[model samples]
Target: MKFNFLAKEKNTVVNYENAVAFPLTPDYELYAAVVTTSLNASFYEKDTTRLERIKDLIQKSNPVFVAKLAVYARNEMHMRSVPLVLIVELAKIYSGDSLISKMITQVIQRADEITELLAYYQMANERNGVKKLNRLSKQIQKGLANSFNKFDEYQFAKYNRDGAVKLKDALFLVHLKAKDEAQQVLFNKIVNDALQTPYTWETELSKVGQLKYYNEAEKQKAFTQKWEELIDSNKIGYMALLRNLRNIVEANVSRYHISKVCDYLSNEKAVANSKQLPFRFLAAYRELKELNSKYVPMILDALEEAVMASAQNIKGFDVSTSVVIACDVSGSMQKNISPKSKIMLYDIGLMLGMLLQSRCKDVVSGMFGDRWKIINMPKRAILSNVNEYYKREGEVGYSTNGYLVLEDLIKRNEIVDKVMLFTDVQMWNSNMTKDSFAYSWNRYKAIAPNAKLYLFDLAGYGQTPINVEKNDVYLIAGWSDKVFDVLNALDDKNSALNYINRIEL
Candidate 1:
């Protein structure tokens, strides 16, 4: 028998599209909101709206669960900003014990996050205009003070530059007793602005950028050499390398360095260690592809290998289990995920949909908008398939007609073990009848009794496109490849909240 978990009936809420949908429980809502955020505006919601919704959810959800989610998002999911936001928001109302301080130690993984947390604390507590931070949250101050021990003088100096809340400001705000005489001296340096400048990727690049060249070709040559030097010195990080592939290509870096890049990118261990969201590879691929450089093919091959490496742990089923992956290429999905990003929500859907397709042995994948048309795809060429879908998304007009996927399957009397919909989950039916996604799902389930539906929520608008509580349906939220791990837990009769609850604080 399939794993079945039950919960109290969830109330309905009208989504941004004015469609009837099921509202997620507070913990589920918080997970969705936290994981899918880049702390920026999505298609239908502004940044402030998203922040307010998260704050309100934190106010109502269990404090322990909220703390665990913050740690999970930071350490496991490899998110930076949202986890800090979770800690800050949680601190505004929760101080029953050392939970806030412990959460800070767990969530603030990097030195820069120390300042970031304080900045957020300042903003959230409305202490921006105040001359002194005497009224800062004591729990937060304790957390920040403990956090200072995790970094060294050079690490602290790197991010101590100008910002809303400087590292020095944080030093004064949290009067941490130094762990040792050396640490005390480092703290003194932090306050006196006398820390030595550490040689880093940023510092090296800044030095190169200060040089003046005689002509455009000379300037290009200088940059090309600098990039090669950085690569040779191993100063460029995995993520930095991914984001700068286009720069490397444009600067006409040597083929030898390009080979090193491809080698590093394709290394499975490096890919896993980077903890980059799958969309980052897609963004790099898309940008590099537009350059029309000969190295595009080499870099694209490396990226394809990297993304597939990242997908190695995605759960799969036997050939007997039939699956269909449907992606939403609706109009709203065309909007970029962030203000300065070229990656769109639909791109994420396509990348993840295509990645899942690569893992499944027996699967039919296609995109849905005004209509759902099945497209045969190769299992190995994940990024290529996503590009194919991106090029042809316009073929089906943009109307969010997700029901058509099921409606077509029902008409054909096809029985699939699983139907996965990668979408923003703002699904609406203009023909609002039994043909809606929910109604169509009910009809389809009746024909195929063991069928289950999974919604891969890309935008996390806090509402399901269909009722998820009663049906054998599941919702997985996030832009990371790690989100797919939830599938195995779900098959073991675990809910998302259960998954978060299992996180040991």
Candidate 2:
């Protein structure tokens, strides 16, 4: 049997290539590190110690920069793959080839405010629309307007060359007691070094976003080119983790013209939704994975990451609360997923209990078929038994009567703090179908007025029914961590907070 997707036959390389084992060595790190320091303008100001070290790191070809940069950028963007082609191209960002410098200076700064140019390029490629691409190209190149301080930026652009100095230092060396003329010479240098490459891809990217322009023949050629670039007989897996990550990411987009940079992807939202997702690739996975069915744990983890990264103000939330979770285990649940989804869900449910336990003391979880299970124990025990619980539950059918079942729990005059119900819509009532919405609403009110209702929808496929999207239901949309982050933040908010938002006269 084959292992994972490894490059097949090896290719011949000359003496220089022999030392190189993988597609890209650690040397790529130099440029990759730029993702972080890219906007640390102070680094670019003058020949500081840090700047010199970076130059040396790049000149010698170290990989740390790229590897760390990739990891950091992924966390920040919640993205996976970046196009290898664009990564290779980033090496050109400061090629000191005056022409390339003049062309790319604008795009680099934009990386701070916008995502890298490659994401737009990817959409353009996939969509095969030239107009949108042309628009993006112009937008990128337009940033160059800020570089008019010819002498200063010219000096910055060429700062790598010898005899570089700040304006004050340069004035002394040039023997120009007059600072103005010295500045003039510096300005002239910048204008003289400007690149000749004209901005022309605005239309190209626009075409990409729309995706309908490329002819059938051209599309085939583009597909073939992309596929060819990714495979190699060499199986060193030098950057295996990184490579797998990009593969997972780029697969989100179906179109080649709309290039989702293997490393940096640009999307419209601060956070992307899994169901009714914006990007084609994410939505495709949502369908392929039947995401709504079994993505709660993943979402929770993402939420944890996001919460952890956010302002510590989160620490002040009324986390002393607790909840009881009931997850459905109907016969329909026997539906296997991605080879390991069932087991994955079991594992996730166990892990989620732990995360919840960390924040609150009262937490109980159960998997119910015709019967209900009580998973109230320490984190480790639950994890150990979750896999077995799934095995025992294999091939079982489940029934759910949301109202009667939850009502059976002991009632308190005070509302329960939280109620977490995880179920696919497999057993929602039929006779009261029209009132299902009302039933769901009443269940929340009766079971736990003060408690928050969080339904981790696990059966959403193709698309969730419009009605299911009502409040309290969160659909996990992306595989990245962001989904969980949003959920946790949402869940962590106390009902009292919302009550505070509403003040009646």
Candidate 2: residue 183 Cα off by (Å):
24
Model 2 segments beyond 4 Å from truth? 1-77, 81-320, 330-350, 369-372, 395-405, 410-415, 423-427, 430-444, 458-505
lDDT string, candidate 1, 294-380, tens digits = 888999999999989988878756678799999999998998888899889989999999888888988999988888889998988
Which candidate number maximizes lDDT? Answer: 1
Clashing pairs in 1: none
- Model 1, residue 307: what's the lDDT? 89
CA RMSD of all predictions: 3.5, 23.9
Tens digits of per-residue lDDT for model 2, 115-154: 2334434442453544332333332333233323333442
